[model samples]
Target: MMKLEGALYPWRFRVVLGLLGLMVAAICWRIIDLQVLDHAFLQGQGDARSVRHVPIPAHRGLITDRNGEPLAVSTPVTTLWANGKELQAGKDRWSALAAALGQEPKAFAARLEENAGREFMYLVRGLTPEQGQSVLDLKVPGVYSIEEFRRFYPAGEVTAHVVGFTDIDDHGREGVELAFDQWLSGVPGKREVLKDRRGRLIKDVQVTRNAKAGKALALSIDLRLQYLAHRELRNVVTEFGAKGASLVMLDVKTGEVLAMVNQPTYNPNNRRNLQPAMMRNRAMIDVFEPGSTVKPFSMSAALESGRWKPTDTVDVYPGTLQIGKYTIRDVSKNEGVLDLTGILIKSSNVGISKIAFDIGAEPIYNVMQQVGLGQDTGLGFPGERVGNLPNHRIWPKAETATLAYGYGLSVTAIQLAHAYAVLANNGRSIPMTMTRADGRVQDGVQVIPEATAKTIQGMLQQVVEAPTGVFRAKVPAYHVGGKSGTARKATVGTKGYTANAYRSLFAGFAPISNPRIAMVVVVDEPSTGAYFGGLISAPVFGKVMAGALRLMNIAPDNLTPADVQPAVAVTIPRGLAR
Candidate 1:
C-alpha cells in the first residue's frame, strides 16, 4: 500500500501544490492592486457613501420692547424625517413607527411607497422635543430629526400689528417681521458628517461654515402703556358695541409711539383661519374723515396768518350756511354770534366754513402738511397709509368749506394724533418713530410759530373747560384738553356720506399747561346710539390718559378740589398683555 501511495500521489501532490502557489500569487497581486495602484478610486467611493455635509440651523433675532421685554422670540423645535427607501425595507415595524408618529400603518406604508424613489422624506415638521424623542425611541430604521426654529409672540395680539408673524419655514410674513426680514434672518452653517448605511450621523468631521445669528431689535413701545391703552380701548369698544376701534398714544417731545392698539386682531400663533380684515392695523392704515378734529389745525392755520385773533367774533345767526350747491349746518343751532374759541367749543360748521373761506386753501393745506397729515410716519410699518388729503389746485367753495370742518379729506388715527401732538409740542414736527429714541431719531421741524401754537393750545383748553365744552374729555386733577369729533362715514368710492354711520373721535394731550402725551381714540360706527365723540370717545381718552399720566409719574398741572377724586386701586391682569 505504501509503495502504491507514493507512486500514485507524487504527480497529484505536484499538481495540487502548483494550484496552491497560483492561488497565493493571485491573492498577493490583488492586495497590491487595492492598497497601491487603485487605492485613490476605492477610497473615493467609500468616502462618497459615508460622508455628507449637514446643515446647522440659525435662529431668528429677538424682538424686544424698550424696557428689554420680549415681544417676539424664536423657539427651538424638531422636524421628524426618514430615509424612505431604508424605512420601506422594515415593513413589519411600520405599525410601531406609525403609531409612535400618531399615523395609521397603511397610510404610513403608502407614504413610504410614494417616496421610495427618494432617499429622504419628511414625516412631521415642528414637533416638540419630547415628541421627537418618543418617536426615535421606537428605533425604526430610517427615522431621523433636524433642528429648526419657530417665532412666538409673548404679547400675543396686543403686539400683533407691531411685531407680526413668520411662516413655517421661518420667513417673515407680516408686520415688523416683514419690515426687517433681512436683519432678522440668519445664515445657516454646514459641517462634514460621517453617517452609517442606515443614514444616522456617526461623528462630525469638520465645519465648513459658521452660523451667523440675527441682530436683536429694540422697539419704542412701552409695554405698560401699551397694555393700558389696549385694555381701555377694548373696554370702550365692547361697551359701545362698535364695529371696530383704534387708539394711538405718543410721547410728544420724543415723537415716540408709546402705545398703539387696534381691535379685531388675530393671534399670530394660531393663524389657521386668519382673515385679512382682523389683521388690519386700523391706527396706521384705516382712514376716516377727522371731522371737527381738524378744526384746531384749521384754526392754527388762521392764527398763523394773523388775520383772525383768538377773540375775534364770527356770524352764526342761522345754523346752516349755503356754500354753492352744498349747505353746511351746525349741530347746535346757535342764533347769536360766537367768538373764534366759541366756534370750536360749540363745533359750529358755519363758523369754520367762514374762516376756511377767509384764510383760503394754502394756509390750511400748509398747516395740515406741516403736522404730518397726508404723509407716512417714516416708521416703515407695512401697509402704513398716507391718507387722502386732496390739496386740489382749484379749491371750490364747497370743497373748502367741507375741508375746513374735516369733511373733504380723510386722515388716519395716527395722523390725527400726530396733528394734536404738534399743538401740544409747540408746533414742532417730530417724526413718529416705532424704534426706540436713539441717535437714529430725526430732528423735528418747525411746523408753526411757537407763539401761535401756544395761543391755539390755550384755545383748545378752553374747548375742554368751557361751560358748554366737552367735559368728558377733561381728566380729573389734571389740566387736560381735547376736541371731540363726530364724523360721517363716506360711501366707498363715492361722494355721498353715510348717515347714522359715524366715526366718533377725540384727539388731544394731557396736562394742557405742559403737554406730555398726545392720544387719539376712534370708535367706528358705535352701535349703542350714544355715538357722539364727547359722549363715547372722550371718556376713553380721559380714562386712558388718566392712567397713562399716573403711570408716567407726571405731576398734575391742575389740582382743583372739585375735580379731584380718590384713586381707584389698579390691578393689572397678566393675561391681557399676552
Candidate 2:
C-alpha cells in the first residue's frame, strides 16, 4: 500500500509539474508577443488608455493701426473644461468645485447632468489666470484648464466699425476682423500626452505638429483720427438728434482711410447685447442719394465737355426749370444769371441742372463713372455697397436733369469721400486702401485734366469762402473746400421719397493749396428742424478735417489773421487755383 501511494504521489507531482510548465510557456509567449512581436499594438493600446493626442492652440496675430498702435490684440486666457463622467463621479467634490467655479452646487450639478453625455465640456471660457489658477488649486478631478487666447480691442467702440471683434473661438466676426480672418487666425498643433486616470495631463510625450502663430496685420487707420472722428460724429449725431451718422476721412495722397466712424456704434468688447444693425459699418455699406454732393462731379463733367468754363454764366431765371414732367428748383431764390463759381457758392440746383443738360448725358455719366460712382470702392470691405447709378441709356430728360443735381443716383459715404479725393488729387482716381502705404507711390488714372480739376476746385473753394457759401465748413487756419447736399430719404419698399426724412451730407477736402485730407459726413434722418447739409453735416466735416489736418502737420493755407476780414476769408491758394 505504501509503494502504491508513493507511485501515485509521484504521478500527481509529474502531472502538476507538466501543468506548471505549460502555464510558464504560455506566460513566456505572452511576454514575447507583448514585448517584441506585437509590441507596437500593445503600446498603442496602452497609449489609448492613458496617453492622448491633445491639441496645442496657437496664438492669434495682433492688429495694429498705421502708427503701430494695437487695435485688436489677443491676450492669453484660461478655458476651463471637464470630463463629464469623471467630474460627476466625485460627489463629495461637487460643492467645492461649484464654489471654485462661482456656481450653486445644485445648479452646477444640474448643468453637469444636462451635459452628462459630453466627455469634454467647457465649464468657463476666458477666465483670468488668477481665477483659473484658483480653480486649479482646488484639485478637482476631471476638471482642467487650457491656455488659449481671447481677442481684445483697445480702441473699443471708437474703432468698432473698422477693427471689428472676434468670436469666442477667436475667429473674426466683423470689420477688418472678418476681412482678414484667415490672415489673423493661426493653425493649431498636435502632441501626445500622458493623462492620469482622472484625465489630468501628467506629461507631454512629444509634439506631432508645431503650431504656427497668425501673422500680424497693420491697417491704415490712424487711431487718433479715428477717435477724433468718433467724437465729432457722435457729438453731431447727438446735437442734431439724428437717427445715425457716419464720417469718413481719407489720406488724399495715399488713399489710406485715415479715419472712419459711425454713430450708434457698439462696443466690440462688450457684445452681450450686440444688435446686428448697430454693428453695421454704415460708411462703407449704406448708400444715399448724395444730394448736392453729386453736383461737384456734374460740374466736373460740364468742364470736361469742353462746352462750359468756370467763369461762364448760366441763367437760372425764376430759379426753376421744367424738364419733361419734373421741375427742378433752387432751395433759395436767386433768380438771375449766376457764374459757375456763384452757382456752386449758392448750391444752385437749377443752374447746375442747366449745365448738366447742356453738357449731354454721356459726358456726365462718363465723368461720374471716372470718379468711381456706381461702382465699388475696391476696398473689399465686407458688405460694401456699390451705389446705384443707372446706365445713361435708360435715362429720360427728367432723370438726366435730376441726375445733374445729385438725384437719380446713390453713393456710399466712402464713395463720396473717394469722389472728393479724386478732385483733391487733381482729378486722378487712385484705388483706396485700408492698409499702410509702403512708400511706393500709386499711379492714378487721370479722370479729368489737371486744369479742369483745378477749375472745379476753385469753384468749390468759393462755396466755402464766399460770405453766402458753406462758411460752416471753414476751419480756423485752413482753407477748406467742399459741397453740401440735403436730399429726401427714399422711402423703403416703395419710394418717391420721405417728405420728413432727409439725408444731410457734406463732402470736401482741406488745405486747398495742397489737399491732404478728403472727408465726408452724412447725418441720417436728423430730427432737428435744421436738416440742411451745411448746418448738420458741414460742421462735422470741418471739425474732423481740421483735427486731422493738424494731426498730420499739414501746413495751413489760409493763415490770414483771425481778425482780418479779407475779401475771401478762405480761398483756394493761388498755386493750386485755376
Give the top-scoring candidate (lDDT). Answer: 1
lDDT of 1 by residue, 469-538 (tens): 8889888788887899999998888778777899999999979878989999999999985999999999
Error in Å for residue 358 of model 2:
1.3
10 residues in a row with least lDDT, candidate 2: 1-10
Candidate 1 TM-score versus the reference: 0.88
Q: Where does candidate 2 stray beyond 4 Å? A: 1-34, 104-106, 561-578
Q: Give the per-residue lDDT of model 2 (tens digit) for 58-153.
A: 888999999999998888899999988877677689888889888888999899888877889999999989999999898887888888889988
Clashes of 1: 0
Q: List the residue pairs that clash in candidate 1.
A: none
Deviation in angstroms for 482 in model 2?
Answer: 0.6
